[model samples]
Target: MGQTLYPAGCVLDRTGKPVTGFAGMGCEMSSEAIVRAPGAFVPGARYAQHRAEGANQVFVDVDAYGEFYHDYSPDHPMTMMRDRDNRLARLSLGMTHYQLVMGSENATAWSAGVVHYSHGTAQAHVSIVWKVKNDKDRFGGWWPSDRLPLFFKTFTPTEDEARLLFGAADRLPLFDAVFHDSVIASDRWEFGLMKVSGMEGARFARALLYGTPTIWPLDRQEVRRTGPWLKAAHDDFRIAHGWNAPVALTGFRWETADRLVQTTSFADGRTLTANFSSTPFQGLATHCVRVKRPEKAAIDLCPPALPTR
Candidate 1:
């Protein structure tokens, strides 16, 4: 098969509507939207391990489709990258689902979004994102603080502050994140530079700019492309939101001559593995699997339990 050069696309809203432009738009759909549209959500098989353990956990894995998986914990959201030396002040905890923005040639950039549904509670949050415009290197985009979890709701950074924190030239990149949680906790979240390569960054940029992946109601027949760009945008969403943990994804479990990479580890007694395929067609895809229950013995062994008395 030949490669697609400058393939056309557009951005879709939660209600399956096209987003007209990039000017301060919000997600109109609600938590019920995800519940009603089962086809739009990722498969249950993809979440088997996490489902077995429970819904709320500090760390979790996400499948970016094709062949990529990454980790994230509430403590540090961007653990998959090298510059993840920061803490998470607040995080949206719930059953999270992602979507791609595909439309006609009217749009000019790449974008994706995430909707978080609170488990055992009637609350949900949403985030629509895009890559920074005019940036030639690294991965970092503009994310609106409009709907952040309660604790950091007031976190409105100036253009310079946001650019410095994300290490991007554009103060406002793309995407709008909506966090809707009544309870906000006082937590620590630090901002740092994002670590990414030129090719990786450019590929993601191109994906957003060209590829047309399938979305809800709109299947492969509708989009007409495999949507590698959409997958890349989704992967970047995890990066921007700090969904993976750094300590857990430090090294590789295995790597093949064909450029397939895997990382496996044991955290809190549970077995976890992340897979990545660096091939050009499937480079941005991610798949993750977690197993077993957290080890009570490991928690008991922590030095904090020694007691100060």
Candidate 2:
């Protein structure tokens, strides 16, 4: 849980206006789940919609990351739920899910991996693993085996972006990049799991939201665009359903990226640049680049030079 601000006496900037926008202090979480039902799975299938003849299982998961390794302990509610699930299953159920909620500063964080049985038999299962941490720390902690067993590469959460970067070498773009790639890679090793279970789209959603339909335009534009189509569609949908948008739900921006270098400007006069690079051996990688702010005035008090005579 987090605190809310009141505008009556909220902290303001030099202009005396109420401070607006995120303080660059927040968290990012991601989740990935795979469900398989023995030999009945189909390979290379799109499963977002239910066909008239049959229905496929669709799973939605949540994840978080923190500033340190210990953030995965039982103190956080999400983590506690995961640990409790682990203790009860005792390997019989395996791990199925992950949750993470990191707050501003290294002071608050939580993470966990979970496993559970799907269908009537234990043959079907789900696994979710995640990490949460403070916003500023660039190099996240090492991978722990308390839940899913795989080595996650180092990563830094991006500020106000639709993507995440990971790996020690050239930061290869992990598509949407919020979810850990190692978990997905490990999931691939399961028994013909991806081909039949219609898990491809599910996994795709974990990295890229709206998958190719939305991403293709982003790929072409290399920018996020807001459109009247969204507003029109939203209003039309509301009218059709006799439902209105939530008071707090302002709107969403459609975004995409194809360039290596990108910059983000904050409402508080702070700007962040994402620098990316690639090597023949290492492939793609990204590093934390800081923005240099203007320095204050300084006095020049050098003594007068000695007379040439």
Candidate 3:
């Protein structure tokens, strides 16, 4: 399991006063301005002076990858450059000595060199308010039902959120351009093939567009239910870009106003085009993923459409 270690210090505002929380930090505020003063610590009284004064190490799990920043503690200052170098050194050591395939949670541009692939790169992180409104049983425990709940499968983002999360207009294929040859990028495992519900078509389309490998949860029953769809998607991807073909994502553009198309160029002079349009494309009944490879006829992968709203 991958982990990120952050140095402990009190987060400070622009005026150098320690902020209580992350709210209203704004673009001007720097998290790196955190100080190691005793008054700055949260729950200041609980931690003794000796313990707080000692080297502060905060460990974050793979699921909640923490941000990397400079630590301004005069005693043991950790700069951004130092942190990155440390991470790179560690990753290099692991790969070289252990012959391990290194992966992480989120694929930041800087870490792309050492890390092989990353999950949770594409996800609509629901706000706390939305979570509370939607998932009543989240805080209070509830018995598991025979079938998965709608909350687990479906999510509807607001217009701004949708544009930020799902719209292809503002996105660039820079990551694929740089690391597509070596890495197998993917979505979060929690939102895998059998997990996502209403916006399944959009997720699949995004995967094809980004040339990312599909993430599948390790649930036997769920796999039994949705295995065929997953297999077919994989098969289409595998056939288009051969098992060992030197493939590169060549082009991505808006085919139509609502339609996003991605073209993958293979080393063998063949190209694969994946055209994704919102469900009911040209009055079609289902959400469709249109894929065409050189010399082969175009095939549409249409699944039963669901209400995204």
lDDT of each: 0.24, 0.23, 0.51
User: Runs in model 3 with CA error above 4 Å?
Assistant: 1-66, 72-76, 123-163, 168-170, 261-268, 278-309
Tens-digit lDDT string for candidate 1 (210-306): 1111121224432243244344345533332223431221122443453333323322234222223333322323322222235532111000111
lDDT of 3 by residue, 1-309 (tens): 011112234433335444343335522122333223334432122223324556232211241143544544444456666645655655544445444556677666666666566776555443533453345343221235544443234345456655655555556666676667766667665456544334566666566556677776545665666666677668756654557833666655555564455445544455444445444544332334555665777666554333333
Show how many residue pairs clash in every candidate, following the order shown: 28, 30, 0
Better of 1 and 2 by lDDT: 1
TM-score of structure candidate 2: 0.18
TM-score of 3: 0.62
lDDT of 1: 0.24
Give the alpha carbon lDDT tens digit for every residue of 1-309 in model 2.
112112222323334443343434333210000112123212112221232225423322222212211122121212335433322332212222212111111111122232111111111122211222232133233335332212122222343121221211222323212222111212221111122122222222211211111111121121222233233223422322123221111112211243444333322232333333331112212322223223623111111121121
| lDDT rank order | 3, 1, 2
